[model samples]
Target: MLRWFLAVIGYLFFRFPGAIAGFVLGSLLDNMMGGKTRTFKTSFGPSPTVSPADFELHLLSLASLVIKADGSVSQSELDYVRQYFVQAYGKDRANETFRVFNEVIKKREISAQNICNLLRQRTRYESRLQILHFLFSIASADGRVSEPEVNEIRRMAGYLGVYSQDFESIKAMFFKNPDSAYQILEIDRNATDAQVKDAYRTMAKKYHPDKLQHLDEAHRKGGEEKFKKVQEAYDQIKKERGI
Candidate 1:
């Protein structure tokens, strides 16, 4: 059904006002087909054959896939999306961003290949950076950085215009080794028992999903798992110190 619909719309490009009609028809199909995204006010702006606004909605929808593929999506992952959205674009766009993002995730309609192609066409520079960071955000969101999530993020980075050299830097920096519990807690592994406990407390408060508005169910689940690890790590260290 989706394929036939997509092909039909693709053909409509030459038969009618492709840009205006195609965008509207595709968006309606997306809604009916359960496409996850927010509607933006289409302007007379001649940017690209594809719509940047529409592409961002799809990007975020695809991003949630990276986050949830491994059965988890963390507070860190959601946090990164929010931050990257603001940094790359701004709050207003980010607001529209969440609308489509959570919508797609809720519906679970993800097409990696199609999304990658669309992003390649529409985004660059900071928009591209937002995509890469959103992937890293998913990898790091769970704190422990599961291998599956890392691999998914890498695939996503490839789509997002992250070149090999930059990707290497990101891999080395974020996925090179298993992140330590101390790392999650943002403290020294060698810290005295009390300091480690303090860091854990701080992180727990900081990453609590309730504190993050608009966080989806998947992200909340991931946050709970990460929080569990933080708690366990601190407790284990305290036990060793007999404190």
Candidate 2:
């Protein structure tokens, strides 16, 4: 569909004033639909691609991955995400991102593979990673780790062609112990027993698996694993800290 539209636009551009009329119409449509036109160099023919709505869906899914990583989404986390949009694409683009995000949140089902194809076509690795990191940062925006958000990150990661080991390494950069704790939990090494207990109580309530069991089975499975890991991490911290 994308190729067809581009071919029609190109032919019209070279063929007649009628093409100019198409350009005006297309521009208006593009503005209304959230699309940007760009020239591509292809040996065989036009690139196989879908519409900008598809791209918006893809990016919005990635954003949700961040918000849902631990188990629950918070207002602070959402604010961080909006700030990310402002930093990366400005307020206008951010508003479009939020619209797409709202649509995804209401979706019945979504696939990361679909997102992968869109990202492969529309973005380079650095760009995609930046988006992913932005999502990660948002998950921890409230200065704590939520289990659901982490699980979402793991499930959606495969579609990005990121190896699990490599992804863990990147994850380590954000979360303190990719194995035991979330990076945002940020419990100090020398904290008092009371502080450790307080931290554990906060995290325990945050990652309760039951809260997210209603998600799709696959999603629930991932959530369970992350919740277990969170529990394990918190326990280890307690044992060491004698809290």
lDDT of each: 0.59, 0.56
How far off is residue 11 in model 2, in Å?
A: 13
lDDT of 1 by residue, 86-138 (tens): 66557897787787676756786577767876666544333443345446655
Q: Positional deviation of 191 in candidate 1, in angstroms?
A: 36
Clashes of each: 3, 15
What's the residue-level lDDT of 151 in candidate 1? 78
TM-score on alpha carbons, each prediction: 0.45, 0.49
Which window of 10 residues has the lowest lDDT sum in candidate 2?
36-45
Which ranges in model 1 have alpha carbons more than 4 Å from their true place?
1-50, 86-92, 104-108, 124-130, 158-166, 176-243
Which prediction has the highest lDDT against the true structure? Answer: 1
Candidate 1 overall lDDT versus native: 0.59
